[model samples]
Target: MAPALKRSYQFVVDNFLKLLLIPTALAISNKYEEIMHLCNSMHFTSLHLLCASFLIIYALTLLLVSRPRPVYLVDYALFKPPRSYRVSFAGFMEHARMGRLFSEPKSVHFMMKILERSGLGEETCLPPALHYIPPTLTMAMAREEAELVIFSAMDSLFSKTGIKPKQIDILVLNCSLFSPTPSLTASVINKYKIRSNIKSFNLSGMGCSAGLISVDLARDLLQRHHNSYAVVISTEILTPNSYLGKERAMLLPNCLFRMGAAAVLLSNRSSDRRRAKYRLSHVVRTHKGADDKSYGCVSQEEDDEGNVGIKLNIDLMAVAGEALKSNITAIGPLVLPASEQLLFALSLIGRKLFNPKWKAYVPDFKEAFEHFCIHAGGRAVIDELQKNLRLTNEQVEASRMTLHRFGNTSSSSLWYELSYIESKGRMKKGDRVWQIAFGSGFKCNSAVWKCNRTIKPPAEGAWADCIDKYPVHIPEVVKL
Candidate 1:
């Protein structure tokens, strides 16, 4: 069979149950008149009416009981560090030189080049421990950074939502590289004095996309338990994970990743809907870990001198492309309109059946979402996604601006992008948002949200101080 025939056949096979429903409905419609006549002839007695009512109620109860619970976003908070923490490019270089981590001049030059091309602006901040000469990487210092970043965001979140720690029934936190003993979740519980019985989870080594994974997990927990609230914190602690290795691939992270954290509150209580910011619509995740190339594309490994750092494989972009292709394919049907879906399918089948030169249709995601929070990982990642998705600069303004102002903050970066959009007062009730992120597991994750209410510019947030200055022009490369 031709490739088109095979794909068509597989589509049918995959959606057999849905296809079966159409014919079954048609057959029922053909017998509709007969069924109505039979019902009219049999329902004359009071006992019969009572039996019919009971059956109807039983079916309705089953339907209600089987459906998943709705999840609401109560509120969220982004860490706003002190102005004293901000680090300029010159200050960063001076600190690096003071640390004397790079033995060779070429390595220093490589780092400077990476910094120039990196999308980060002059105001991005680093942890206090990193400011000292021969920067401190002690476990104690790492804990201090973690506490400050996590607690600041959480405190703001609790205050904004007006919810006490005792109200939280579930806690989920993710920090990709830092998972000390007693766990980050335990730290939150201790600080907040949460209930002893709260279900808590701490996920580490999940990489930049871990924020959505935490959200997905919290949603699942909310659905299982009624009238409960869950708190999810996403952050990256740089003190322990900062690469001191002179390897160029390993050094790229030092130039990009910065200190940041975000906290989000999720609730399943029906009464909370009136005050919620957004409603969770969909969560789709795609993992390409089955392929060896994809599995090893981004990983933390020890170099020749036993220095640990996250290495970016040369094939990282190609692997990310494959993961994104798989992810969009899964999410397209869930979010795209029926007309767009039909056009995309027909276009693909046509190319396979007729001319291979025919351009394949890329469904217009703008039709589904009013806002896009593409993870602010780096300049190249954002550029490629914008070109492929055919998004206008205005649509991607939040992502680009977040990258410039906050740097690549790993798992928490998506929240910063969302905050940027909110800061610009672009979020209106009923509008939809799509958040996309990539991670070291060579995974692509997407979350769709519908605004529950019109959002005003925040009085305090990561963007509150400088949002007016942004949508700044960032050149392809800085000549520095």
Candidate 2:
């Protein structure tokens, strides 16, 4: 159909109920005198009261039907790679040296400096492709990495939740750098033999905050499809994204990112509430893509050498800060206590009217949430957030530790942080968790979750083997 015709059709579909109401309203108007006369007759008084009761019932039914469905986080799983894939700082540097991608001593030295300070521990795993001397960035290798991470998490999630693949009504899969033919979502459906009619979405190039973006999408879908289940798979295919260039800006991603993925099950089913871990409370995403600096702060492009990589601009931290401020400003009223909101409002007014230079009041988010899963982007990312949010060591502990254990897993890092909180037995009934992530679009997205019940330490997970060793002392600088 033509654009104008399609829009006209859509407009009619949207207003179908209103169109029906309009005809009913006109009929009621035409019969007003007859209705008034019938009301005066004794037998018609009972019928008038019956019609008024029916109208009241109809209005109540409309309200119930229009209300949004509550979205529940039924369960989630995080992928844990085998121990053989673990790469130490020395191991990573040696592999880079052997790859001959960096023939210059200065390039190798720069990577060393980044690795030492990247907040990644020696145990973080990389895909087999990256472990190669001249890393195999083949399409097949990338698919293998995706399947390894995504399917592992999915298997665990399905096993734990006992939710069959056929039961899922929606599927959302996100991989920032690796969108292939037979998209990842399509691969998942084929592998699991999910129903052909499943509403599926494949998201690419969204960056580290894309996981929450998936959650936001799934929540909206669940609200529309009542009693439905949605599964979100989040991961970064490190095999292909591994920068093999000499540019310092481009190489930062190689030294920081590692293997990780998460599968999350979301549902609007009232019966699933008893087993659900948390309920989605709010999701606020702020995008600064309109601004050139924000849009280009993190990008995937070919460098002067014609070698493609994800570049990190010097202004990334500053860009992220601005995006974060905008996101929090929008979400504060929804999540913060009334007292905090009032104080924030007063401070804004004071700053505008009286003193522009006065330090902006930062509301104590500690009072608002019991836990925080700040994205484990890197050491600098975590440090800046801790300092800016005025978060305690314990509040940022999960994030810091996740970065150490898994390195920067892109969007999946937030889920790893939340898993850390659960593994440490920090999650409790009624406790609220704030998950904040910054991504390539210079977007800062936040998801707030309210714990549905007391959470115990996991029997086995990414953190199961190493949870006790965390909150480890991370030096400001490490000497190799």
Candidate 3:
């Protein structure tokens, strides 16, 4: 058994003996009282004996129910950049304009400045096919890109698992911006020819946090159905939605957003235990609606210029800080080490007595999580989150680099971050990872995954090849 498991087992064994002593001692004390009462009142022996037996059974039941059950992560997969793709901020800008806009001196200068700073400026660019198409065909291009990325990801993931698509019992797809006539889930079903009776769900408008929300939903289904597998696909459509013209707020999305997707397969069957990594540990969701002031912090809207865009307000960092505190408060009691919990409680008490407004210092999370996959919304957002969480540069590197390389893939960005870590060969057996994302509805969501075992890393998969020189320090802002 692993050292941690051994420790847990020892603790349980020690506690079990103590617990057993309590019932025996209580029963002895009660028996004396019963004996005295029986003699004085002439009560029947049968009634006293029955009452004692009931007490013992009830106490044992309580102990059994309170003991923890081990939950394991079965298997996981991620999609990222292929090795041949490298598009700098300048290159992306130049390509996105399709030569028409880049022909202008100002446009060329702006693209060059941005590219020089962006890490990708020095890297190789992707195939010509990945560049932006004409304005009239933007929608068509968006759909094609969406299909290409998603299918490629799913194919790779399924290949790794050796699980036939037809064998999957549940399918869940989340894409926040685009939902065509036949949803992406339907497309998957048709392409793979999954069973007609397969249960499926498509989530739209749930924003970036929707990936965890989908995992939460899938977990519930797995627990209820038993012995079943669920496949989840997450992606975002970036072509038609690309913002053009000079609206600063509208330009933000164009600057940060990128193309990517991820496919994950989850199963509860005990037979397939060895292949899984990062058993689902916990999930927490917090939502503050649009009416809330914090809603504007990260929401998308049309500016006074009549251009539609997403606004990355400053207040979002503060709001996310508070939401994280609440989430940690709830999750801590469940997973925090005993020593940390005691310290945290003491700190809480000290704050209440000495400084009522004082924010309690959260425990060092580096002790708990080996990897952190924060959403790659933008450079500023990634920087703020790292400082707020007290994360190391390396800890936030994957998120920063993912944004720098692929831009924001919306709900699926977390997967790309995970891919970055994997591509670097950083993951190992029993490593714990945390994924946090903030999205529309002013929502902040988190998922904790603990790897079951190390497996072969996927090459020629998603972003694996492009990550070595990523996270270019781009200064010039280029519209997508």
Candidate 4:
């Protein structure tokens, strides 16, 4: 047979029984006596063989499709700041230039207050620029910071996975604030000497959710390019993009955003299944950029004094809530259990038909996922998500601890939270993890991962030092 005809024959041989079995079973009620009589008269077991064959085919096909060779997360690496980089609340106040810029006595006091109650631990690291005589945002400083973070994470990731830079077929790097002249993609390739033809991308201005976006992008590419490996690097360069202004909104990013990065390796090859740590199950990204409220909520621009800073609007939480609602709505059908789906549908119907204003039900996501990594942007962001999702303190512990220890690592925060969970031995084979992030553009994106094998905490991960002491109490108000 010709190649096309052979393929058609094989497809029919595989699926024709699956198609024929259901209607045959359904027809049994009307034709039961006739079929039995015909079978007995003909002294033929064709009917019995057909029924048995259909059963076998149906079961095999179900199993085959259910267990697709999903994209595998071979391994990941996180950038852990050294002890010298670690800072206390007092150190941040003295070095961050925020205190010097806000020389007025009252303004300084307010800034100190915000840092104290920011839910960040004393160990969060500031960038090298902040330690200078006068805080620097020079291009050289940005390059140094970018190189330190990106190289560190990638080196560790390559070492752990035993995958060389030349082996990577696709590279996606995300840095929200820093977009240099040569571009980060060129920098990474030139340094590593990757093959000239390797596909590469340097994504800027994606904010905290850029990591998920990178994963989504990689997943799509892997689907088109078989047996390919993709590397995603998520980092934020704080030196040049550091907000130096004293505006409360601008200053918030300074206290919250920290220096960190993560490198993840994803492979669609069948050989990767045995060694891979997690399988990529689902990725849902929702953009509210078209809406004025979500679009203007988190924006990076210069202030009246020509000081460049990211201005976080007061309605950020509300905007985030709206974005999250849209995200879960799209993802719920895929992950939610039948019971939760049915309840949500009934409640939605009731509100539309009866009350017309009844509070719509929020499907319990805890039922869908074994672990949750909510965005670790800030205390307010985590607190609001916890309340909105009705999550327990334990459920949000990883997120809160990631924020406290690493502060807001931008696109890398969710990975830090996932590391926290793994460090505590919370991840198990077949377990599902939900990672959700909110970034600038008021975007909320989620990626679902299923543990492919027993996950062991990496000895050199960011949480290796303090994972045991997390979930600590934080006072509503603290004085630095």
Candidate 2 structure quality by residue, lDDT tens digits, 1-480: 476984575567546777889989999999999998886775657788899899999999999989888899998999999999999888988877777886678889998998878888889999999888788989999999899999999999989999899999999999989999999999999999999899999999999999999999999888888889999999999888777778999989888889999999999999999899999999999999999999999999998878999999999999999998999899998887665676688899999999999788887788689999999999888889998889999999999999888898999999999999999998999999999999987899999999999999999988998889878998877877
Clashes of each: 0, 0, 15, 0
My TM-score estimates for the predictions, one after another, are 0.91, 0.88, 0.77, 0.87
Runs of candidate 3 with Cα error greater than 4 angstroms are 1-86, 95-138, 304-306, 357-359, 456-460, 463-480
Error of 4 at 273 (Å): 0.5
Using lDDT, give the best candidate's number.
Answer: 1
lDDT of 1 by residue, 1-480 (tens): 476984676577557789899999999999999999998987589987799899999999999999999999999998977778898989888777767776567777888898899978888999988887778999999999999999999999988999999999999999999989999999999998999999999999998999999999999999899999999999999998888888888989999999899999999999999999999999999988899999999999999989999999999888888898899999999998665687789999999999999988888888779999999999989988998889999998998888888899999999999998899999999999999999997899999999999999988878887988988999878766
- Give candidate 2 misplaced runs (Cα > 4 Å): 1-60
**Once all C-alphas are superposed, what RMSD does model 1 give against the true structure?**
5.4
lDDT per model vs. reference: 0.91, 0.90, 0.71, 0.86
Better model by lDDT, 2 or 4? 2
Tens-digit per-residue lDDT, 1-480, candidate 4: 476984565456446678789888889978999988987896658798899899999999999766645799998999998888887887766654344665556545666778878888888997778776467779998899899999999988988999888999999999988999899988999999999989898889988999999999999888777789999999999898776666777777777888899999999999999999999999999999999988999998888889899999999988999999999999999998665676689899999889988989888888789899987988998898999888999999999888888899999998899999999888999999999999888799999999998787667678877777877887877676
Which of the two candidates, 3 or 4, achieves a greater lDDT against the reference?
A: 4
Candidate no. 3 TM-score: 0.77
Q: How much is 429 displaced in model 4, in angstroms?
A: 0.8
- How do the residues 1-480 of candidate 3 rate in per-residue lDDT, one tens digit apiece? 477984675466436767789999989897997879777896659888899899999999998766433334454555455545556655566565564533455544554544443333234323224464434335566667677878888888777888898889889899887788788899899888999988899998788888988888888777767678888888877665655445444455554566677888888777777767668888888777744775666665676656565666657667777666666777776666654566678789989888878777676577678999998876666777788778998999888777666667788889878877877888998888999988777778888888777745556666555556665555545433
Q: Model 3 — which ten-residue stretch has the worst lDDT?
A: 119-128
Cα lDDT over the full model 3: 0.71
Candidate maximizing TM-score: 1
